[model samples]
Target: MLFTPTVIKNLLKKPATRLYPFTVREPFPNYRGELYIDIDACIFCGTCARKCPSQCIEVDKEQGLWSCDPHACVYCGICRDTCPTKCLHMKDVHRKPMTERIMMVEKGEPPKPKKKAAEAAPKAEAEPKADDADKGESKKADAKKK
Candidate 1:
């Protein structure tokens, strides 16, 4: 019969799919699986939040908080790529299946106020003191000469 030969050939071959749960396939190199943050390196600049296509990331600079709604994330890696501190990273393995929705929140030290501007302010204020000293010395020299 026409069907008999085809069915016999299919049955003779091994199953096309593997036992998924029992035998997981290794992920390819550079696979963007799960997104995680290195809280220590994060500056909380909101760059990642701004670059996220899904807008799942939330950054609180004052509070030093970085939170992401994994459920809303598309895992596009834009956030990771745009992070200034290179704190964002992607794991090769996917996130484990979750029954309940949860927010991925990280707490870190807030960015310290830049001291360069503050240091420059004091230097500018000090320069006038030097000029005043030079003026005083010149006045003393003129008086002594007279």
Candidate 2:
């Protein structure tokens, strides 16, 4: 063990590896790093969650929550690529080491439901048309055509 080349190299030469915690390394260009979502820009679509191969993303449109499990994410960048609103982005930096898994959740306003035809019809019938002159002209034209 004393004669080992590794021991001799360690003693003679500088360390090949840097102290990671002390020396931070910058990520390369086009690197598919951790996921980052712009919650304000997001439209609460489940497209990102559906596109993720790891299935780490969870989108709830009704409650308006977009969550991602960092522990389970493989950093594949599929979610970012497939986001319709272009809110999801792949950042160069990654999340720091954590003891426990944490799901990142962003809450937003829920989407408004569309008005049904039955409900809309009553509202239209209740309001009186203001342009009586235009209506009379249309009726006169219809009578002439008949």
Candidate 3:
């Protein structure tokens, strides 16, 4: 309560600074820094975009995707909770630079899970039989006649 000189001096010590761009300080566990949506896992649900209090989330349901303007976010973290797939999260990143205000929109079906070569061993071994190979009885009859 008392504005003592000693207390004031202690508080003024360079004020914690992050070296940003060169070195990023990881945000606290609960710190809502920036929103990131895992488009691959997203089900195209509009819950996140709809629940946004600031209306900063942009989701195109018909196009099956979503994105948000980094500048417009208030870092409220509402979208993260509203996401059904839990695809949305507040990543450990601070406000972006002025030159990077917009987020790139990524759309399309998620990459199919790769089938390991070992799993496909059976298919590779099963080669199609040629027509000549299938006519074994006819070839035997012709050879006996000759």
Candidate closest to the true structure, highest TM-score = 1
Which one wins on lDDT?
1
lDDT of 1 by residue, 21-92 (tens): 999988987999899999999987778866777768878766789999999999899988888889999999
Model 2: which residue pairs collide? none
Q: For model 3, how does the per-residue alpha-carbon lDDT over 13-130 read when each residue is reduced to its tens digit?
A: 8756767678777668887886777788887656766677776665654456577767777888888877888988776656655764567476846333247764664344233223
All models: lDDT? 0.83, 0.76, 0.67
Estimate the overall C-alpha local distance difference test score of candidate 3: 0.67
Better of 1 and 3 by lDDT: 1
Ranking the candidates on lDDT from highest down gives: 1, 2, 3
Cα RMSDs, all models: 19.6, 18.7, 23.0
Task: Give the Cα-based TM-score of candidate 2 against the true structure.
Answer: 0.64
Off by over 4 Å in 1: 1-9, 115-146
What are the runs in model 3 whose C-alpha is more than 4 Å off? Answer: 1-26, 110-146
Model 2 lowest lDDT segment of ten: 125-134
